[model samples]
Target: MSVTAAPGFVAAGVAAGIKASGNPDLSLVATADGKPVAAAGVFTRNKMTAAPVITTRAHLEATAGHAVAVVLNSGNANAATGQQGIDDAEAMCAAVATELGVDASQVLVCSTGLIGIPMPIDVIKAGIPSVVAARSADGGQAAATAIMTTDTVAKQVVIDGGGFVVGGMAKGAAMLSPNMATMLAVLTTDAAATPEQLKAALVYGVADSFNALDVDGCTSTNDTVLLLASGLAGSVDEAALNDAVARACASLAAQMCADAEGATKVVRMTVTGAASDEEALLGARYVSRSNLVKCSWYGCDPYWGRIASDLGSCGIDFDPSKFSVSYGGITVCRGAIDADHDAAAVASHMAGRNLEIVADLGLGTGTATILTNDLSHAYIDENMGTS
Candidate 1:
């Protein structure tokens, strides 16, 4: 169990024939009692938004961040289809709401898969009852499995917050970047909380977790992270709730990076000594999303020049002559030039499945870290075809 592990939540996934392979494509999550819970969502900043995203945002607003259920489908993104797409998303929500005896505004929707494709509304509607009937505590794994697009494995996390537990599941592999990507996540907690408190915790959690990962630098139209809390497990302080949610999101982020499409190495880029933490993040993001840098990582090359160039291009004030770069704790570049060290040791370290690169700007006390993966020929192969 993932989401259901938090208690007060029931989840299920079913094969609604939305996928050509007849795999599980529909997933539903709701309170165990079919009542609304405190809800907060973070969506993609992409301007070319998907229909499901629009509907879900509106529902959250209409209900003032209270929701009874969430319905999601894979294999068709229901994006870029204009008004028809919006209607289809609403219809999906309506069907789920009808079955649960809840208002449409209390049911949120999300879709992922190939973009620009219309949703199979009738097939999904017909399967709503079955999914609703199948809801149980044991269905969290199935729900996690159903949301995957190109992910090879389900991502789930459960964290103990002293008095309460926070559980979550997420799906994403490619198209991962800062500000989110082609990902959908649901977080549940039994700890008592208001919608405003949930929003604050989610914002704090997402900032350093999901929003810190950069895979292929492509943000999706359907990226969503929704947190729901049922006041069943007694009360928890805001700080504890925020920490627990952040821990869960961070775990999920690491899992996504490990399962990234065609990735061979998971890399952590730490930027330090920036003029500001924001500038440090800018520098880290530039290096993480640089194709040159990613390709060098794939080849097990400690190409310090690429990192230097990326940091310089971040538009942040950094003294190139004073900055330094290190790979796997070994200084590779010092004072913006190559440093003589044991080349064999550095090469051996880069060959591992996990690695870290550090860039010290020698500016001020500001730091940030970015999690990413190496670019490979297989990544191109996977994206060259249909998404």
Candidate 2:
């Protein structure tokens, strides 16, 4: 839940006067080793993305998907601002490069908060120097807090006992569904990895993690998950690199589920015995995002039918007679039919902060796990406050 300072990287967060509320809105995370050896990004599916997303995409492409620093801001999405917005986002990157003595293409930019607002470029420009100067190892937490909108707490994860070190932070609360979510996450590791290897590892990690969660079934135009490897830990060892990236990503993904907005419970929907991993993920994600299923969990209702029905409708080829379900270690349904398990005990188990729903397809060995949050009135109230 916390990231200690690692060698070669320094981060800083500053009140850039971008937000009307006067909170820190700009942050910088950079490495002293110059450019990162490898990087991978998963972006929002929303077609109407912000200027920063557009500009960053271009930079990543131009650099063949590598970066040395990331500059982020909150309170103004910098979306829908057209040409000027693009100009401003690039300017932010250029400014950071000037301060850090790196190429502009080596800096990635991200923004979040109210949509349709133009960035406060003047304030951001003024704050750049200070943020650059303030960068240090422990600045990851501050950078995480700086990019939050309605989030009640900063999301961070770290694992250091292994031979390599991996750490990361994420921000999300509302508008969180996948094809990406209304979220921004950054992960760093000292492990050495080639760009291709890093990209592969990230794709594998997110397949069963960030891509699994949904808060309100709404995707943000700015959702992005970026991973950077400084290679400061030394030459690449394929196995070690994979382990570090997987551990870091898994930890951060769990944090995102646990901190889902107004969520009293975090659920893991595991789908097994499918014909393929893709089919299992398809079915599991369907159950995770079903409003009725989420509400059942929130209300402490043992509605196994809702869960089973949602999974069945996901367009995966499966026999109804082969299905089975369990809630919190209690088998509530078997062979495509309801079980005689005690509903009251299952409901009580669902009331806790963590819940697990296992679905067996009885088809094949392929499987996948989806993470999600329980739906609640408070989630509605929190997001609607700004609307």
Candidate 3:
């Protein structure tokens, strides 16, 4: 149990023939025990959002962030299908609501995969009954598996905060960038929290985790991060609750980066001593999103020039000569120039599957961290043949 690790939650995953690969592609997570939960979500800000994302946003708004269930599907992103797509999304929500004896507005929907294809509504609808029947506390793993696209492994995390617990499942592996990344994550908690608290916690947690990951610099139309609080553990320590949620979200984010499509290196970039944290984050994101830098990392090249040039382009005023760069803690460049370190040693250190890059702006005490992956040919092959 992951998302279902919390009290008052149950989940199910079933195959509906949505994916051409015949993988499990439909899932349901509900605040079971016949109760509604306090829920809040952050969706992709993409102008061309998916139908399910639009429908879910409306549902959350109409119900004041109160939701009973989440209907998630993979392999067919119900996007760009016009009115039919909207209707299909709404129908999916309504069907789940009817089966669970909850209002349609209490349901949220999400879909991922190839865009602009009509949803197989009938096939999916026919499977809803069985999926509903399969819902159980132990079904979290199934639910996690069903919501995966290019992900090689299911991402889940559980954090116990003394009297309360925060648990979640996430999927992403590609089409990832800042601004929430191409991901779908649902976090559940058993703590007593109001709608406002849930919303605030989700916002805080997502910004520090999901928003910090960049795989290919392409955001998904169906990206969503939703949180549901059952309040089954009674009131919780607010600080502790927030910490648990943040830790869980961060854990899932790390897993997604590590499992990123065709990525051999999980790169953690940290920027320190900027004028402000925002500037530090901007600088880090600029470097992480640079294909040139990612390509360099993939080959274990100590191309400090690629990293230095991007940081210079970040528009942050800093003495180029004063900044320094490192690869896996091996300082290769200092004072904006080569540190006279052994070039072979630095490149060898970068050969590992795990890599860390640090850039100190030497401006102020501001700092930021970003999680990203090295670009590889496998990523190109997987994404190119997805249709």
| Predicted structure with the largest TM-score when compared to the true one | 1
lDDT tens digits, residue span 1-387, model 2? 233344566677888888778888898778855555567787888898888889888988889878989999988888889999999999999999998788898899998888877778988999999988878777877888888777778887776725667778778877777574568888777777766777787777676566777666688888888777776677656766666666766777677777777898888889999999999988887888888988988987778888778877888867778888888889988887888998788877877788988999889998988878888988887767553
Question: In candidate 3, what are the lDDT values of residues 150-180, reduced to their tens digit?
Answer: 7889999999889898989989888777484
Native-referenced Cα lDDT, model 2: 0.80
- For candidate 1, the per-residue lDDT at 203 reads 94
Give the candidate number with the greatest lDDT: 1
lDDT of 1 by residue, 33-108 (tens): 9999999999999999999999999999999999999999989999899999999999999999999999999999
How many clashes does the backbone of model 1 have? 0
RMSD of each: 1.0, 2.3, 1.3
TM-score quality measure for candidate 3: 0.97
Alpha-carbon runs more than 4 Å astray in model 3: 178-180, 342-345
Ranking by lDDT: 1, 3, 2
Q: Which residue pairs overlap in candidate 3's backbone?
A: none
Better of 1 and 3 by lDDT: 1
Say what the RMSD of model 1 is: 1.0
Instruction: Enumerate clash totals for all models, in the order shown.
Output: 0, 1, 0
